[model samples]
Target: MANYHRNNVENVVLGRHHHHSHRSKSASVAGHTFRLWNAASFRRIIFDAVSCGASSRYAARSNISDEKQHLQQKQQHHKTTSMKNNAKSEKLSDLLSIAEAETDVETKKKEEKLEDLKRLVKELQQHEEDSTKNKKSEAAAKVRLLAKEELEVRGTLAMLGAIPPLVAMLDETEQNDVNSLVSSLYALLNLGIGNDANKAAIVKVGSVEKMLKLIESPDGLDSSVSEAIVANFLGLSALDSNKPIIGSSASIYFLVRTLQSLDDESSPQAKQDALRALYNLSIFPGNVAFILETDLVVFLVNSIGDMEVTERTLATLSNIVSTREGRKAISAVPDSIPILVDVLNWTDSPECQEKASYILMVMAHKSYGDKQAMIEAGIASSLLELSLLGSTLAQKRASRILEILRVDKGKQVSGSYGLGAAVSAPICGSLSGKPDGGGGRECFEEDEEMMSEEKKAVKQLVQQSLQNNMRKIVKRANLPHDIVPSDHFKSLTLSSTSKSLPF
Candidate 1:
């Protein structure tokens, strides 16, 4: 019985030992899992904070720059589109799809519409060509007419392969049947107006050269037909790309010849169109040399007395004086200075006045003889007033010329007042005698007509002052009122009488 009791006690102790060790192992595993989870969560929070600070500024700058560039590109594209197209009358129901309220949607529609129109024009051209090739001139003509309408409606779309056949039609038409030729040329003209792309395409297909030949040729072409062609040519020169090509083709010389050749009584409008085209072509520096090569300057100089031609001529001469060669060419003309002075004298349009002033200003700036010629032609007083009275652009240009004129006169009046008396002289007639230097304008006298309203008013005031001062002189000298001859002396003085005595 003692041995059995000892064995049961030993078994109970071993069972208790095994239960405590298993519980301890489970507690250690739970503690290790909690530590690992805490570490991972802490690492994630710190990583997020660092990323927010470090990457956000650079990323934001990059994003903003990208967005700004995109907006600029979008705006430029929009402007180009607007310049080339007229907005179609979108249907009321279609407003939701095309309205600017939904910018992205509307923009996509415009792009798609432009693309569709281009494709349509291209197809029309192809059909026209195929029909014409098949000897189906009637169908070809109809297709061309439709293409012309579409091109007019969609301006730049004329560029998409439509100009080629239209130009070819001009050549293919019977020389004697100018009526049919007129239709084709008119179609091309409508297709080209304000459509810069069409101009590039036209130049590419040698239409300019063809038109040059057509105009130069004696087809006994109708005046209206010639006018349409010239007007269209004028429109095409509105494109910068066409200017260099047109200039190189001797368009300037021939165009001037055409003007001179046209009967003055017939096609007056055609003459104006030719002048305008010449003016537009003059905008290019390359064309300046070509224009100077012809007698166009002489034509322009002679036309200056006519108010209608003066404005256009002045605009052309303005561009011409921008270069050394042009200055020489203009000054080289015998009547150039007088013509410019005439424009300033009689023209009532402020725009024309501004152009004339600028041309004179450029000439005066270019050479000594040119400056002297301007003064001799009596332009200084007009320009001085123009500086104060003209448009903002005109004001700046005239002011600059006046400033130079003052300096030129200052040198001439070395002994008049102070060293720079001419600079301070308020009027062209401030000094009584002729300028020692010739580059300045003629000094005003007591009796000649005033060219400007301001000068006219001032002259009236001067006349009143001279009469009053003469009456005072007669009273002070105790002479008879009738013997004073105040009526004869009303507009004169010792200096003024001498000025008027020549009359």
Candidate 2:
């Protein structure tokens, strides 16, 4: 039983060992399955991890590209903003330059305007200062009556020195002020200072030209202005050296016209004054020709015909006839002889007759036998007729002509005859006969008429003797003593048988 129990124990122990072995196997299998499952799970997890890693890398790359794009856009925006700022800066610079240029131009204009205003103000101030100084000096000079007059004279002289201002006053639009100024200037000129410098100053002021305009103005002038102008011109005329001023063509023509326009009936004094001025002007040789070139000759000749104008006209004619130019001027007028003869015939005044006869004598001297030519031109008979009613002046002038002819005849008789003698002799011989009345004499009712007629007869005799003597003088002038008589009076008797009168 022990043996069996031991065996059973062995069996039981074997069975237990087998069961332990099976369990050991089952545990091994389970451990292997678990190991395989863990391996697969780990492999799967690794794969998943790798895949996720790749996806995350791709996402990161896309995110990086987006970030780069955003950065580039921001850079472009910054560049555009910077360019706009630069453009604004350039525009502001251009506007600033234009504003500066405009400001400079306005500033220059203002400066120039300021300069002009300063100059004008300076001139005005100077004028006021000079005027005030003059007034003060004048007040200081007024001490006594004689002293005052002396001071007044000095003041006038000073004012005359201030001719620039006085003349400028003429341009003022105010008429009364202009007149007063002009009047003051006239008084200054007439102040008997006789300062050549002052006179020259007045001339420089253009007062002469202005005064002439006042005379010619259609509106006329105040009497004082007229008188002053006349006086000024007369004073200037007396300054013979100033005669060149008359050559100013405008001045000369105006003076001539002014003289012509004066009515002898209305303003005889003015006429006389004008005549005197003309006479003064005539003293200039150039003015003589200029006067003749105008209607002055005709006007003067017409004036001579007027009773009122006779004396002055004669005086003027005498002045004109004294020069070589005067001779030419007298000869220029074709009707001068007849006009002069008529003047002689109408006037019984000694002075008038003397002047007329003197003019004739001058003509005789110039014309020689042309005196006969004048008679043949119908002037000689009238001249002889005029001589029949001569005054003492006429007789003297007539006798003077005869004496000249006689001297000429004495010289000419050295030759038998000359054209001058031949022309003069017959006209002279014709006067040797009696008058139309009996006994070679005529009676007149009026004592004055008789005196005139007697004077005329004496003039005629003198003229005849002059003509005969001129013939002898012409004949003798070209001849030897043998061919022509030394004494012409002894050679030829007064007879109609000698030669026929040309006329």
Candidate 3:
């Protein structure tokens, strides 16, 4: 039993050992499986962990890649923004340049406007200065003119005193100083000192010729210079009639030509002086026929119409009709009697009235027709009225005409009245009854018949006389008389009438 039990125990021990080995192997395999499984699980867990870790790592790597890509995208976006910012800065710079150019153009326009204003102001200032200068020049010219006038007056006074030095100074003076010189010469001529000897001295010095030449000079010699020259020449002409200094033919021609030349429209004073010179020349019997043959009578008649010198003209006409030659010269005119009668009736001035009356008296003494014409012209009645209504000079002239007419009437009883018989009968009345009647009574009846035959003859004669008188008055007053003076008269005997000449 012990043995068996031992055996069993061994067998059990072996079986147990076998089993334990199997169990150990199984446990080992299981442990291996468990280990494998654990390992696998661990490996799975590890792998999962690893895979998770790897995935996490990969995720991390992916995240890192995404972050890097995002970072790259952000970098690209930042670059684009920087580029846009740069472009905006460039556009602002261009706009600033345009504004600067516009400002520059505006500044230039303002500057130009300022310059234009300055120029206008300067021109205005210049114009004002020029106006002031012109006014000053005008004032200076007036002052100079006054000074020249005063100097002439003083020089004239000195020359009249017979100051030799003053005369010499005038001779040596420049032509521009002729105003004073001419004034002095005029005064010396008026003084009438040192008669023939002084005149001879002046002629020797060529003063007469110089004075003549001065008429055409531009120095504005006075009208008196012409008068002085005329007097000097006339005196010289009279003094040496046999030995002419300025040649007799030349002198006469020059005088006549000068008289005509003085009739220029610009020279009133020259015309007056020329007329005076002609009057002096006419007084010379030697020149009377020559003057009458020329245009001297017409010129004188025209001068009678001059307003500036009618008084001198009337005196000249009166002087012309007084002498025998003068009467003949006057009769040569176509209508002299009517003209003179007209003058007598028209004027109110005492001097003019006297002159007209004087002419009428002379005409009445000339011929039977002249007396008859005067009577028919109402000149006889006009004379009577004038005698009643005139001054002493006019009344005396009218009385003379009446006496001449009375003489003419008395002469008509004897025969055809001669001028001498007509003049003598009224003064003495002795010739009135004288038996010297030739054709005078017949001529008287014929004159009466002729006077009655013409229609309104007496009225016409009176009307013409009054009209002519009005014209004479107008001429004397320097006015125009276009209307007939007789148009206002109503009477037959005392009224203005037209006269017809029997001759």
Give me the candidate number with maximum lDDT.
Answer: 1
lDDT of 3 by residue, 478-499 (tens): 8765644452343543543232
Of the pair 1 and 2, which is ahead by TM-score? Answer: 1
* Top-down lDDT ranking: 1, 2, 3
Q: Which candidate number would show the highest TM-score if scored against the true structure? A: 1
TM-score of 1: 0.55
Poorest 10 consecutive residues by lDDT, candidate 2: 412-421
Candidate 2 segments exceeding 4 Å error: 1-178, 192-201, 213-227, 247-249, 262-267, 322-334, 345-348, 368-370, 373-396, 403-503
**For residues 314-338, could you state the per-residue lDDT of candidate 1 as single tens digits?**
8888888898998888788888777
Give lDDT per model, in order.
Answer: 0.63, 0.55, 0.52
Task: Please report how far candidate 3 places residue 212 from its true position, in Å.
Answer: 6.6
The local distance difference test score of model 1 is 0.63
- Model 2, 277-299: lDDT tens digits are 77777777777766666777667
Candidate 3 all-Cα RMSD: 33.5
